[model samples]
Target chain A: MSDFTTWDILRNLLLAARWTVLLSLVSFIGGGIVGALLLFARTAKGKAGPAFVKTYVELFQGTPLLMQLFLAFFGLGLFGIDVPAWLAASVALILWSAAFLTEIWRGCVESIARGQWEASASLGMGYVQQMRHVVLPQALRIAVPPTVGFSVQVVKGTALTSIIGFVELSKAGTVVTNATFEPFKVYGLVALIYFCLCWPLSKSSQILERKLNVAHRNH
Target chain B: MNYTFDFGWLIEYWPVLLKGIGITVELTLVGGVLGVALGIACAWARALGPGWLRPVVAAYVELIRNTPFLIQLFFIFFGLPALGLRMSELQAANLAMVVNLGAYGCEIIRAGIQATPKGQFEAGASLGMSRLQTFWYVVLIPALQRIWPALSSQIVIVMLGSAAVSQIAAEDLTFAANFIQSRTFRAFESYFVATLIYLALAIALRQLLRGLGWTLFPKRTAR
Candidate 1:
């Protein structure tokens, strides 16, 4: 039997952390695009659009992500569509991220006052033009902090993908623990690596929130 | 390709599902109270308590918030035993859920605390309230009333998150699904039913928390 050193373990874990990074990136970016579509659908001038978006958000948000992964993995298999663990994990997280990102973007968009919309409409602007020229630009400012904060959540969300056999940092920790018989050291390093990934995002989110709230500070 | 669906397993496993729901409720209820309590304590230590303890509380909140609950669960369930601390799967899951929700709950509650007006403190002091009494009755309750909605949502998030605890063989709803799936080879059906139960639980829990919020903060909430 070959013995693994701490270096061997950390190196392997970092190797797996690469997947964690990749998965988070794919889900975040994919979710952003999908969330944008949901945002449009949500804000479009219709009764059905916003209601559908609400149900979409609630359906995704109300369920556990682990179950979502399982459903995507096993649910698809029932349709004779074989999916690797990573693919299923990505699809699930993307939907999960989209639901949250859509809601965040909706909140940001809704924070725009009615006057802006009315003014844009009074100028003969269509819905898209109003959103483009007036509402979204302002909403983007309020959106940045929470969006960045949610990225930390996205990164952390990747950790659960490990449950379905996607070998991210958490799964790597488990595998390394079995190999080295040192769970404390292995998982402590796991948590530390995550902290390194997330602390700066959280701190900057706080800083940005403070800066953004400067407008309200005077009141 | 053709496939037929069968829910016959569900009928046979009704008792298992109910047992799983019971365990899940137990986990959420325990985790919610303890977790929010931890949040209040941490929020206090950070906001208005001793200066020396601020950094420690900050680190605790950050550490728990950034890491995933699954890893935290693994760290406690698998990692802690190596350090001479051992616990059952239920105990470990409870601890992880508490710490995770506590970090989130701390941030939510602290926002409420920070938003309280400066004059409220003066009013309490003028009314002959000690610092302790003032903080408990004046600062704490009002802050809670303000943040109850956000806090209720956080509690529900943690409640949904309890579904992950079944990973450690904690015999929760998800664990029951896994068991039934293994026995019946109906993976999709099992998880679907289990996820539905979880969805129902989340919705019901949210409604219950909202009702609790209305009852608890009746004076603050206007009709």
Candidate 2:
């Protein structure tokens, strides 16, 4: 076994962090699509649709994401589906994101007043039209800060994907640490990389919230 | 490929699941209580401590907030031993939880502090309460009361996230699931059951925290 220098460890981690970023992007984008559909269902014209979506959100939100990833990794295999770490991690993460994003977006939508909805209805606009022209425009404002805040969470969350053998930044940190016997240097570097990724997002999210004047204490 | 799901482990491994649940609860309790207390101090230092200390606290908050808890745990559990600071698995897990939760709890509590009107602090001073007394009676309590709901959610999030603590062999709920599955060849069933138990815990915890929040600010909630 050759000695792995700090530079070598950092180099390998930088390569793996790419996958972390990629997984975060995939999960966020996939989640956005799935979440939007769920949000619509949540607000659809009936008690049943909204009720079902509520349970769906609660189920996802209430359980540990680790368990979800485990199930996705093993459950599919039990059902005769060949599960790769990448595929299982992606699917689990996307579902997790979808549940959370739906809840976040729903909260944003709910923040829009009843008067706006009624006014839109009185103007001969249907539900979809009302959302398009009035409701969403306003809800998107309140949604931006929290959504950005949640994205920070999503980035941090990608680290958990390493558990199922996805070889992301965290896993890379472990591999390098084992090779170099320099856990502090390797893991510190890993933490630094994650910080670099997340700090800008955290800072900008606060700035955006201030700009949008949506930094309400309650949220 | 004929796959059969058997739950014989439920009866045979009841004690294992119970033990895991017990350990998880203990970790959450310790982590939640100590973490919130640490957060209160950090938030205070950030808001009104000596000018020299503000930047230090800010850095701590930012660093922890930005990194994943898993890395923090790994660094403490695996990396610290390299530096000749050794701890048991349980110690490492609890320390990581406290540190991670403290960072987040600090942010949440600091937001509440920032929202407190200046007049309130002045009121405390005018009443001849010492600075420390004023902060305790006026600033910290009310801020905590106001932010309790958000803090409650954070506690649950930390608890849920504790599942990852098992990765380091802390013998929490997730560890038990992995243990039982390995013994029974029923990974799916084990994990599925674990998820349900976690779901129940999360829901129950949220309710408990909400109740705790109301009790923390009886005056505010009485209105």
Candidate 3:
């Protein structure tokens, strides 16, 4: 009854996959920037800074990403803001990813040891200088694997944005499924596409983890 | 800024909200228990079971870990019907959660198992214990103790992700939020309340898991 050949479905889903990749990139980059700021605040030697960052991370981490998308989509509407689905999805994902990234990075930062801080302080280094020069370089090396690993999550998260009507790969699968009456094939292709996107990231994260931890392995 | 925030719909929709929460909890309980059990079996397969099973379990872990939970749910709920395997939305949701968590739990539990000192296995052998008995009595408990925190986090994560089950009309907590919003046209309020309830549930689940850890591994708590 429908004219959606296999090629047609594949082509449409591929087109939508572009948006999935783009959204993942946008949120990962945006979340990285915000997460870095939160990481600094969280690691800084102050009561309020750590507490505030903690609450922000906990709030985002505790709630469902779907609910976060809904709030961004509709809560903004209550304030006379014309929120588009893409905007809501991007903003919500950025915030959500930032929370996780901040927490992940906090662990990396904390692993740098209190001795490093004391030694830096003994050299008359301020907190900023110590962090910029002494701590971050070490933390950055440790953080790379986990950060890359989290990109897989960001990519998968873009799937949830389809519910908010962003028309990404998963949404395209649904649309194509309706048109072609081939739910199994369409969804199977969708899963295959996601696995293709995600597997490399997961593999590289494992490789990076092993490679980066070589120094500690001897200990 | 003259908009008034009204939550009068809460009075009427409380039952719906309660049912949603109940279902969400039920999903988490069943998913957590079965998923971890499946994880244990897979972990054993990968770590100590037959050599042929290692690659099979590895592939399953990688496949589930790499894909989004929603697509897995969709495959089970919508895609499987094409092959003549039919089930209710809740069953599909439960199955998806179990599958998703099992993959993750396998990885986490495997890490714990790998950390087991070689001496422990030999000690079990010297004690005249069979391989399975050695695994059950000497290996699994300590391994579980080591990875309990990570497993707890994954379970909580699976619970939060269960929100996606609502997309297939599984009547989860997120579904309640969607239903209430559609009925009352209070989209923001409905989602806001649901989000808070999710936050509460997450906190409660974490605490419960921590308590369970204490109960299960009393030696660790005593330390």
Candidate 4:
């Protein structure tokens, strides 16, 4: 019912983009912490920890993130735990991101040769010490590219939070579309913003992979 | 917390849920088949096709890969009519999934194509095969064989991501959950059931794809 010029739309969307960036950062950082813990548990000596982490990762990965967000928003409310959209979105995205991150990191950690573990043990190094001293440092290097790459996923994922009523870029786009009746321009701009945010991360991930491989070859 | 869970709505809502599941599977089947076909074409173009086409294919792949599926769907469903391009919700959803999976599948298939041995191409040339013939009979099959697992995983991802189509009222499985919850006021139960169904679908799809891979690439299984 109001006139919205191109600049008006762009300004509103840009303002909302901050929430998108913040949510991505929160989920990525939180997911990384949780994923690291799961990675340790997954690689720990014993059956239970690894198995539990495996199931945890599988369950999260197997379902849609939208369903997860719905369950978080409504499921939490069912128990009288009134959750705001941002909290629900953050929690669901964190858990989902953690699942993928743990799996990605597990692959990286496992790629460290078995000899490294055996040699560390022979040197009287404990599991934690071997991981801390040798395996993780090496794994961290390989992990950087994919981790940065997955950050793009985290950013794209923040788009889903809009479905749960979070006033992020995508949601803002929808609201602006209603106000301006310009769904084409609004959604196109939304896609462009997402592309700008994600392409650099995707490109860097590819470059990092190539760079790391060169370093490995030179070694 | 003293919250009593009621799945009583299931009896009444079974048909709606069934229809939803049916649509979701239909979307997946159509999206998966057509998507992989488009991917194969793009992969060929990027990897082995003419010089002018590679950048064009690369730009499409990069654009799709870097954006979220939801915006793409919104663009197609809500945004496209401004240019006189119109489609039904279901059509838009299917098109979105196909386009989404094609980009991902292109990259995956390209990786496989890139991994092909240089000797294979020369061998094909010596066998009197044209470049397209060589790609078809010699390179493409083995490349697909090498990347079947990865491609299958991407399809599953695209299938899961299809849940977002419900935002446009496309009546997929997630839409079923939303419907049942609104009617029953059993939001958690409805979503919980839907989540489990998705898990089942994902697992089943993975297994089905694994079997399909073995059938398609018998040599892999033999080896």
Candidate 5:
């Protein structure tokens, strides 16, 4: 067995950090698109739409993402269609992210005062037109801080994909640790990589939260 | 194409699955209660403690908040043994759950505490209450009442996140489902059932917490 220096381990971890960043972006963007649809369905006035959205949210939010990953990866094989880890992890994280993003965005949309919706309706604006012209603009402002905040959650969540052998940051750490017999160095580097990835997002979320609060207060 | 899905394997393993569910609930409840206590303490320490200790509390919260729970679990279960502090997988997993929940709880509770109106503290002080007495009877209690909803939801999140402890082979619901799947080759069925069970537990826990909140914070009911 060969002992690796700090530079060697840091270099490998930084490389694995790329996959973590890629997975976070893929899941966040994919989840945002799907979540927007779900948010629309949730807010739209219809019999079946609300129930379907509720079930969708509960199904994803109620269960653990790790199990969802397992179901997507291993469970699909039972149906005789093998799924690559990339596809399975992407699909699962997207669904998981959508559930959360939909709820966050819905809260933002709903926080718009009742008077705004009524005024748009009084002007003969249709539902879609009203939402497009009046409601969403205000809601988007309220949504900014939470959306940025939840992104930190999305980044941390990509760690679960490692359990399914997708070879993102955490899995890469495991491989390096086993080979080098340096769990402390390997995992410490892993934590530092994660910290480097998450700290900015965390700090920015706080800053955005304060700025939004100030804006709300000023208005 | 024709396909068949069999769920008969569930019948043979129902007892085992039920036992796993029981263990899952036990772990979540134990972890949730202890975590809330720890969270409350951490929140209080950060909010009202000496100036020198503020950074210590902040660092603890941030370190746990930023890292994924899986690595934290590995450190406790796998890494601690190297330091001559051997713990069984279950003990280490349970300890890690409490610590993780405590960090999150601290942040949420601290927010609630900060949001408390200054008038309440003044009122308590005017009634000839000591600082300790005033904090307990006036600030901390009411602060908890206000943040109970957020606190309970965080506990539920901790409970759901507890599923990750299965990575260390904790014999929780997920671990049991994995075992049954390997033995019976009914991966989808086993996991589907596990998912449904988890959903039910989450809903049940939410309702339970809501009821507990109602009982604990009767004064808020009038509002």
Candidate 6:
């Protein structure tokens, strides 16, 4: 029964909002790095590399982010290691985002016509050189829109980390609501804050998607 | 440290796991079917409804699309109770799932609807068909047939997303994993099993949707 004003609640939520932004950045960056390697492995065209990467992507994408967070938090304890909330949340999101980003970028890489690889090979470029020079440049353009769109997913995904007591925006809303006993106002603000964080990226993703579609059509 | 992984716990708790899997499948199937129906309606309204209604539907789509499903579940489960609307966790979870899956499905299906050629509608109109008849006979079914793959994939995504409902204690597979982990202190093993269960369910659901599509759209089978 605390008489906390709406402004006080929002002020606290704004502070917690910083963690949400930080977590999204960490997960997206970490996932981007891991996902790049995974995309490479998936397209490596070897005996077992493709299969291994396929399994990795399927494992993370097929399950829930909440379960992934729980496993990262509590599962590590079973291996005689205790992870902090920050590390656990980051690790789980990185893995989750990696699975998705790998799939997305793989689509980009694969969309490059077969002739480009063949032509690169004919010029005596090794696999690494061909990928580094020829394929990646072309694929990066096709990859931009989807990657931006997927970032929205990554941002929303960080909210799941709050389940493990990570104290992001959603968790902070819970804390504020508990103190104020104003679930409607608290959650409405929570939704609005999330919308503010996500709407710009969402709009840019649509714009990028349309622009890319036009470019692809013209080409 | 000599720690033995007791998969014996898994063996003993097999029935609980099975029951959990059953509940997960039930929720996903029920939610997926209903969500698709809701999606089609919303998509139709957004695409063909009166001008004023279209923007409102668009706003609904955007609002739900950008927010996390977990928070939506909380708002329904926790927030509603404050307004004297008491729902069990399962009802709240299902309602949230339906709302969430519908918004996504609406977007995908609306794209499909727009892709339908205008000529098809003209042909239906030339036959003296009413607007509803033209939409149903000429537009809706054919549009869905073309977009069946995307629509089915979205259903699988919905099924996978159902795992988020566990936070409200829906006793889905993830919830069961949480219970098993606490009881046996084998969090890894518990979640590994749960993940496998989810994978199996996803594959099965995809197959089921494919079968349903084949049955519904026999003429499109050649494609």
Scoring only the A-chain of each prediction against the true A-chain gives TM-scores of 0.97, 0.95, 0.98, 0.97, 0.96, 0.96
User: Which segments of model 4 are wrong by more than 4 Å?
Assistant: B220-223
Ranking of all predicted structures according to lDDT, beginning with the best and ending with the worst: 3, 4, 2, 1, 6, 5
Could you give me the TM-score of model 2 versus the true structure?
0.97
List pairs with backbone clashes in candidate 2: none
Ten-residue region with minimum lDDT total, candidate 3 chain B? B214-223
> What is candidate 1's fraction of native contacts?
0.77
Question: What stretches of model 5 exceed 4 Å from their correct place?
Answer: none
Q: In the order shown, what is each candidate's alpha-carbon RMSD?
A: 1.4, 1.9, 1.2, 1.3, 1.7, 1.8
For model 6, the superposed segments whose C-alpha errors exceed 4 Å read: none
The clash count of every prediction, one per candidate, is 0, 0, 0, 0, 0, 0
Candidate 4 docking quality: incorrect, acceptable, medium or high? high
Show the colliding residue pairs in model 4.
none
Q: Write the per-residue lDDT of candidate 3 for residues B179-204, one digit (tens) a residue.
A: 99999998999999999999999999
lDDT per residue, candidate 1, B59-135, as tens digits? Answer: 88888988888889989999899878999999999999999988999988898889879899899999999988988
Q: What stretches of model 2 exceed 4 Å from their correct place?
A: A214-219, B220-222
| Reproduced native contacts, each prediction | 0.77, 0.89, 0.87, 0.84, 0.47, 0.59
TM-score: the better of candidates 1 and 3: 3
In Å, residue A21's CA in model 6 sits off its true spot by 0.9
* TM-score of model 4 vs. true structure: 0.98
DockQ of all candidate complexes: 0.78, 0.77, 0.86, 0.87, 0.60, 0.64
RMSD of 5: 1.7
Interface DockQ of candidate 3: 0.86
